[model samples]
Target chain A: MKKSSCSLLILVLLWSNGVFGQDLLNLLEAEQKDENQYAPSAFMMTRIAFGHSTEVRPQNVLDVFVANRFWNTPEESTQSFVADRMSSRIALEYAISDRLTFGAGATTFDGLFDAHLKYRAALQRNGDGWPITLTLFQNMSYDSSPIADQSVSDDFSDRLSFTSQILVSKRFNKNFSLQLAPTLVNRSLGLSAADPTSIFALGAGVRYKLGPHVSFVSEYYQVFNPLESRTTFDPIAFGVNWELGDLMLQFMLTNSWFMVEDAFITRTPNNFNFRNPNLNFGFNATYVIHFKNKLKK
Target chain B: MNKVLLLLTTLVLTLSNDSSDKVICRQGSVSFFSYTSVENIKAQNNQVSSIIDFESSKIAVSMLMNAFVFEKALMREHFNESYIESDIYPKATFEGEILDFEPAMEGAQIRIVKGLFTMHGVAEELEIKTKIEKSGSTFTLTGSFETLVESYDINIPPLLAGNIAKTISVDFRFEYEPYEEK
Candidate 1:
């Protein structure tokens, strides 16, 4: 009886192994046909947007822009430009993981700072047939100036601001995707009575694929401050992203440009006198290179 | 009973024959190109592999989603987290076979492959041209194809539409060694 029972167990084990093996094999075959058939060596995208909105009150139209004159021309001065009536910024993004990314950029009218850090985390994915993504982002800005003057009390300083945003995006098709982010802003320093670190902002953006190497992007953001009576700021931007093998270029335009905290945060046109103020209009450009490591699969 | 025996015998022979074919794929430095004019932005997956059994019309392929490195690491992260959701669906696979395969010389030859490809939980019929090369104790296979992201329900954000390509092309080359039969 013991021998018979042992044989039965062996038979069952063999049968189950065969069944499961076949199932696994079948699954493997099926999965091969799915999207992204190859284990990609790496993925990258360069983005840019350019757009502008006029202030509702003509006198309130303040544009802040920061320009890098020495960027493309060797003879150009290294000093940055400051315009308080209109602005623009250009940024480049890189993906470190499937859910996290790092980004840096420079703006036209905000401040002299030429870089920032952006970390995004995906809380949910649209894998199970649902075309929705929930993501959280933390954007931090650094001061651009080497000189530190506490008396300056400009928006650009040794300060840190945190933005908590929830993003929901849906790909309408392979060529197009749309996303909406509702965010809460918290700042360590308050520059104005109208500047509420706890203001609410809304962001809407879209991505469209045109071909194998190019795409277009656009985004709009509106921030509403409840503490400051009837104070709101709307910034719009549009741009084009070009990918050349390993190199990516992004170019964009806008009316509220600043690279660092003080550039846009303190010098945005909304906070300055609209009339007889500096108005700057220009584009921001970014280039990126990717490095990849091979994996043994 | 005779027919059942014959079927079992054929299955055994086919299985044994497949054990002799192997396929390996690798991607070292893959790249992506995004163009606004041609609207041809594409991320190329360099690491891809698969094995095929000509006698049985069976095939298997596998890839690591995280392996897709990008020029901008941030974009890679967003793709894994926000787009492909790499944590939940870490890898993509295909398990199917050529509908009709006839054994040929032990070297490279052109062959037609037909099978069902499942992606993003949806399965679709795929007919592609494949090259099979057999050299003594080794075999190699190569194939290329393209797929529309919409077919798999991959959504691109409107703000990002201009940067991502609608159709992604897939190219593959595999090297295999015989699996010694016991």
Candidate 2:
């Protein structure tokens, strides 16, 4: 009787494995088509702190961005509750295609107007498909600040600057991502006669996700060759990003006073030191709008 | 000796029934719509997989949560990251039996499909009214159902609660061909 019961138990187990309804579902799942899944949210927004990340706005979408920086001068009254000076930048960015994005903005402190074109060359996949994301960025800025020197500010070409960068990024996991940007800057006329017309810099950025809607972001740019005529320091910023439904808000601290890449990456004069009170409190807000239905199956 | 023979015969019958009575759909479509005063969001996934077993009147549906395509890319990102948390629960599935389902039904027949629908690591019993059409060797099944967002443990923060609907409507269609193991 024991032998017969043992054989019966074996039969039941084998039958359950093949004949159960769950097995049918498993079979269907096994034959499901393999779909390409791309890594999502390498960076929460287009800007990682003060520098641009390897992210492009979606096609046919418009982004309205506003950034502000506030700081106190050394001679400012200590009685003031907060910073005494403020700088702001307002921008409108639009994605023409899935891989191409363009934006233009105006800044208040330097009276600078800037425009940029970004192209996404490659996107990282979820698994082992593509290890890194690659993007190319080009920006042009015109200084519109009122200057007494006619030779410096009168000519449109002399007041212009250009920046070119290749942004390479990798999303190691859902919570961490890293990016490196090799940059080249060109100025029609340097601020000082001894300053070089061209500058080379390397920027690094990191994002650590704390939650689905929040992340800690930091960026640093190191100039290869410093300006000979003026004291220049590398730009560094750290911030927290909060994402709402259609808007993103970033709060940051940085030693750079400028908003645009042409000015900040090459001309930042303050060092990010613990003892120095050079850090500026800044915030950025971005709103996105989708123009039309561009869904792809 | 007779008992051993009986066990072997039952195994052979079950294995043969698995292949002969099954129909499969590799390219099915499932779409969901959320209507709200603030915004109306809609997404669709065409890479759904489903199977129907006529011998047992059983049906199964499986789809990748990340496969859903929304009108806006940001909406898709939010759906995966915030709403469904696709990293933790990558697939949504349904396994159920068809009531009064006849493989030899002449024309379009309306049937009730009762199943456990699982999404976002939560499972709930569901009954969907489906329209099934059989012509030659092809079987087409189409249906729509309404499910509450709360039933799936999907939490929308109070601040953005007005942007999404409390209840969502889902529609699906599958065209099944004869299953042949490749």
Candidate 3:
């Protein structure tokens, strides 16, 4: 009887061990045995108007945009505040990889052709993280406008302009986001004797989501011209961003009509103050195409 | 009698060493559908992990919250940032037992599994009807279930509630291979 009880005891002990040992083989242990934590999709788009957001398209995706800014300014030829405007921009942006984006575009407003390189430097996982979704946007534009100002000799190299800006944004919640950009626009051609070529400006943008597909966006840029004698205009714009399947449409009311950053930052012609005429209207459309749906996070 | 005792010991050892009772699936698929008067949204995650121990009648499945891919990027973002709070709870898991299940060497079995499903740090009891298929060395399990978003503490603001279904439909499939000792 003693031997029988000992044998029974060993059987129970081993059977219980087998049952419980397999129970400990949880799914989490077997999956991703040596993988790192997954990366999160921080933002939805590559650009927020003139300001480049920290967001980037997936690798091998191309974005085509046609942004139009039509302003009814008093035509210098007729001196009439009429809708006598034809200005538009066509741009193409491609995400070479997850972290880098290259773009080339042309704007007829200021007669400029520009190319830009955008690099995402940091991502804001959560909270008031430093360098939250910061992106460096560098653009070089060649102004091709006719030398209308006959007072000065037109230097071919003077038409070149370079813009460098750092866009910093934070998504406070699903409904609200804010972006700030410190910009420097360098023009080889100065407007006046006192007008310095290097211009400094601060840009602020806000996005409030009305729904999953629509958002209210506003952007403002404050320009500080170093030369006291040179007058600079600050541009303010409000718009609605509507998203379709793979397309996005942004309709705007603004005081500036120039579509290129080099033309508008501090050199905008339309003033927003009550003393000015009226706000002009504009529209921006973006369509993104994925060449390969290999977005692995 | 000693021979009988030694035989009993061998039987116990063999039972303990038997691994055919367990199965593992590393690439299970899970999808959820939300239908509302305004729109219908769907997402799928194929990186789901599942493990089943037939001896214990235990089933467990785990999937990363962000693993679900949607047709719309913005909707996916809202799911992670607002609805799921994926950073706080990065994964969803369910562990349960199949009711009155017996191992059939070759055949399909319909079983009911009752377990606790947890998402966004909220846990709720769920009962799922599963269709399990056995073919050669593979076992394919498919099932569907329905649950309320509110049951898991997923809050949709009144403004958005009209556009998002309160009741969500979840579907899962797993092709499990017998667990092998590494």
Residues A103-205 of candidate 1 have per-residue lDDT tens digits of 4555443333343333333322234443454555556655443335566455554355555556656655445667776866665453456556566767777
Task: Give model 2's DockQ, 2 decimals.
Answer: 0.48
TM-score of chain A of 1: 0.55
lDDT (CA) for every model shown?
Answer: 0.49, 0.88, 0.75
Q: Which candidate is the best by TM-score?
A: 2
Predicted structure 3, TM vs. truth: 0.70
Cα error, candidate 3, residue A126 (Å): 4.0
By the DockQ metric, which is better: model 2 or model 3?
2
Worst 10 residues of 2 chain A by lDDT: A11-20
Off by over 4 Å in 2: A1-22, A76-82, A150-154, A273-277, A295-297, B1-18
Model 1 misplaced regions, further than 4 Å: A1-117, A123-130, A142-162, A188-195, A226-232, A259-267, A270-282, A295-297, B1-182
Tell how far residue A253 is off in model 2, in angstroms: 1.3
Q: What is candidate 3's lDDT per residue for A157-226, written digit by digit as tens?
A: 6777888999888877667788898999998664676777888998998888786557788888888774
- Residue B28 C-alpha lDDT in model 1: 21
Docking class of 2: acceptable
Please give, for residues A111-135, the per-residue lDDT of candidate 2 as tens digits.
Answer: 9999999999999887668789999
